[model samples]
Target: MSGYEKTVLLTGATGFIGGRLLLRLLDQGIKVRCLVRSAKKFEAMFPGLDGVEVMEGDPARGSGLSEAMQGVEVAYYLIHSMGSARQKGRGFIEQDRKAAENFRIAGEKAGIERVIYLSGLGEHQKELSKHLSSRQEVGKILASGSIRTTELRAGVIIGSGGAGFEIIRYLVERLPLMIAPMWVNTRCQPIAVSNVMDYLLGCLTTPETAGRILEICGPEVLSYRELILCYANIRRLKRAILSVPVLTPKLSAYWVQLITPVPNGVVRPLIEGLKNEVVCRDNSIRELIPVELIPMKEAICTALTEVEKGPGGIPSRQSCFLHSLT
Candidate 1:
């Protein structure tokens, strides 16, 4: 199928994963319309990009959704409220739910062919953490819509600008000896950003992926403590972690804030979620999308390499296209 033949609507274009996916779609020559709250900002980000357009809209506020979804074939739902969860209090949950419902209605009304959503991986039990629960709930809401939905539940996404990776980066780069909570022992399957994007793009062409709840994760499963140690090792920094039961989630968040670029609000729920074992429960996505998955160490190395190049490491879509031409 020709890229021009496929029309895709993308949400969270300003976010880490969405931003990368935007470039990928443009590179593949796919027509993309971004649902952004500020068209000015979006335009500023991709001034001369071709085969792409921006629709001014807000998903959380439930405005401009219908107009944004008009005539789109596939919609990528990457919006989440975790960033504003603390500021919104418990109301963030309701905000996320509302946004999902609005997107569902808009997509259904627009007759979208497929909706691809990136969600978190966790046990479907009452004991799931609030953050994980919200992720899963959004998946459910999107799946309930008239269109077929492909919800990819991922663990910690290792990337340059990702929140989870930032937390790991700061903790390792700043501290040599860490007083960690017991949750540090919790195991998670971390996938590289490139691999995640491949799976996401693969979903667009893989008709069998629709209406499926797929788990995309790294080949290696390691504890949070192990990941931190791995990060330290890659930097050639000797580190030791003393896992203790005394540090509460709030205290851990404050400690993280002191060391990391992340704020206390965003880190709190993330820290709390470390207790849940988030390794992949299923791996059927491998056969569907045969991209070679990056290992934890290699993923960390790539992320660090990009980070070392400064904020401009990740190129804008227009810049990428220009570079390709050169």
Candidate 2:
């Protein structure tokens, strides 16, 4: 590989967005080193892949991160603890802070040039949900170090297999008659998973994105209710969503836990985070990376296709698997 070619380190390579991003990078012939908690899981998720290195590490544990950063040019911090039990105690934030600090120190020692982070879209330094606030704080921590950082803030990503999309899918597929919280009216500008991948890959080629924060979203902005209605339309399902203002975040989270199989730990943060509008506040990323953003319906269709593919397939549609809401 040329010197200009980035030897990238990717955290959360086994995750939904990370998996897609990894495939894109590999297709581009970019060298990649993935930090995974389990080598077996990594191999199972990405079997028979070439031109990639899988290093054993858990970012939350500060383990194996140093080795993963060795000789890496760019590192993508994509790890989150929404699914973990520790999230109940708001431990994800501390874990993320530690991970960011560790990665920064390790990357600095390894001479890494840049760190690219995918974070949630929300107001910074405010009363944001623990999840969103932690994401924002992690970006700040990464930028404070010697390695310059690029933070891409985005709303719920509409892609197959991603948690947010799964929630949308479950609500639409399982609940023909839906009782939703008032947050359903909260606005969001969701980007298709493909467009997000495009922008992430664009970061690899564009040197200008380093040390900057880019807010990204699709061309259309819609309410969470509208998103669900649109998804229902794509699936050709007749759905009715009744938003009840009395459903507190806690109650909504419990409902999600019971109905969607999403654990309370995960559902709570997502529910709380939903209280804030997540539309794109800036268009700097578009100026930097020009790709035709796909429409929401097309994005939903693509995600659904991946979901229908099931395991051992190319995720033909985004995974719509709901966590056991039991």
Candidate 3:
């Protein structure tokens, strides 16, 4: 590689977004180093993976980060503790905090140029859920470092194998009728995985994106109920939902776990987030990156066939999503 060529460090390279981002960066012939806990597991998960260096380290534990940050021009902090903060207790929050602190220290010492972080989209002034609040906290910790940081705050990313997408798919496909929580009426801006990918890559090449917290989302803003109905329409499945005032977050999670394959632990935090109106307040990023924001209907249709099975260790129910409807 030329001396001027950029080398990137991708944390959380094995996740739904990070895995696909890895392939995209590789396709562009970029020099990439992925920080993984076990090289053996990484190799097994991404068989025949090439053109990228694998560094065995756990970001959560703040291990091997200094070496990973070496010679890296930019780094992607895609790491997030996805477990429920309230249900799982303080462990998840602490993990996220430690990782961010370590990463900031490492990147600054190593003279990294930019850090791109995918953070949850929720207004800080509002009473944010534990999940969204934790994400925002991570973003703050990263930005405090000397390195320029670009935080992309996104709401429900509609994609196959993604936890958010999987939940919607199960709720719409399995249940023809749902007496859902009042949060179902909450407004959110959902983006397609492709659009999210484009924006992330755009931030890498676009210098102006550095040190900016941009809200990246689809062109359309939709309510949770409309999003479900949109999925049902695409599948040609008959689904009905009644917005009920009775279901608490815990109860909603239990109901979801009962019908969907998603575990109660994962379901609770997500359900808690549903109460917040996560619609994008800022649209300035569109001018900066200029990506075509896919509509709700088109995004859902494309995601239905994006992946049947989970790749890079993220759980998926897409394989059985259609089967259960019949």
Candidate 4:
């Protein structure tokens, strides 16, 4: 990894995917500056981790970003929020818009060379939910800047700490007989978190990856019910799902929040997004950065194993799992 480039600015390093990416970047001997809301909190999480510079910043408010973005080569935008729905179920879209604008301005001023953003995958022609639209909008804003940007649009991510997997975990484990909404039949392509990590890490050294919009996903397309049953089969839990037309997305969100550790603010928006069939529209990423895409059953098994490890798991509880669908 010698002769590598200069420092890279990483946002959302405290979250599930970002935290893991932090570890990967450090392992590769990349110089990293993390833009976080709290320096103390970041240090507390990683303890004695070296080679990382922590700066306090809120991109939405444009605080501390001018300094954070200064002299950085590339940046990772992983700051998708489920908590943004804290006010009247319509806050996240506006918050995301503002944050992207702020980041674009800061990066442009700082002369950042590139930005790699992970966005939600869905056809724009299909009336996208608020969640998916917000995700894509952020990508658009970031790319609108002078800095070249690579946006990887992903569907349902299958991992322990991810909202999509955790919701499925709780639902299948707790309910032997389940009552669900019609969205349960909606098909989605579920990619393993490991495969996601591979693609992300690959983007770092692959200069050709810059300024591209790559749609990433797993090998199989299955309904939400199939995902549930796959988890059940993996865990040896007997489960049954009856898809009724009655339960609205809001009701389903409440029911899920009651069972899983995921909050209602996050669950509501994620549930609304489930209605859209999310599969990779483009497969260009496979040739750009090749990695063995893990199967749904294996992804389920790995996630369960990580959860069994408690605080020492691969995706630590401290890392934010604020993914929209995955």
lDDT of 1 by residue, 186-251 (tens): 999999999999999999988899999999999899999998888777666779999999998789
Which RMSD values do the candidates have, in order?
5.5, 4.9, 4.3, 5.0
lDDT of 4 by residue, 1-326 (tens): 62456888999988878888888888888888999887887988899998899999988778988999888878999997667432344487888898899999989998888999888988778899899999999999999968899999998898778878888877777789889999999999999998988888788778889989998999999999888887766666678999999999989888888888777777888899999999887898999998898877777767766886756343332232223114
Model 3: per-residue Cα lDDT over 160-215, one tens digit each: 87789989987887788999889999999999998999999888888899999999
lDDT of 4: 0.84
Order the candidates by TM-score, highest first: 4, 1, 2, 3
RMSD of 1: 5.5
How does candidate 3 fare on TM-score? 0.90
Residue pairs clashing, model 4: 15-320, 16-320, 157-326
In model 4, the Cα lDDT at residue 223 comes to: 94
Residue-level lDDT of model 2, residues 3-78, one tens digit each, is 3376788888888879998998888778888888888988988789888988898766678977787777888888
Question: Which sections of candidate 2 miss by over 4 Å?
Answer: 1-4, 85-90, 311-326
Looking at model 3, which ten-residue stretch has the lowest summed lDDT?
311-320
Better of 2 and 3 by TM-score: 2
The TM-scores, one per candidate, come to: 0.91, 0.91, 0.90, 0.92
Report, for all candidates in order, the number of backbone clashes.
0, 17, 0, 3
For model 3, the local distance difference test gives 0.83
What range of 10 consecutive residues in model 4 has the weakest lDDT sum?
316-325
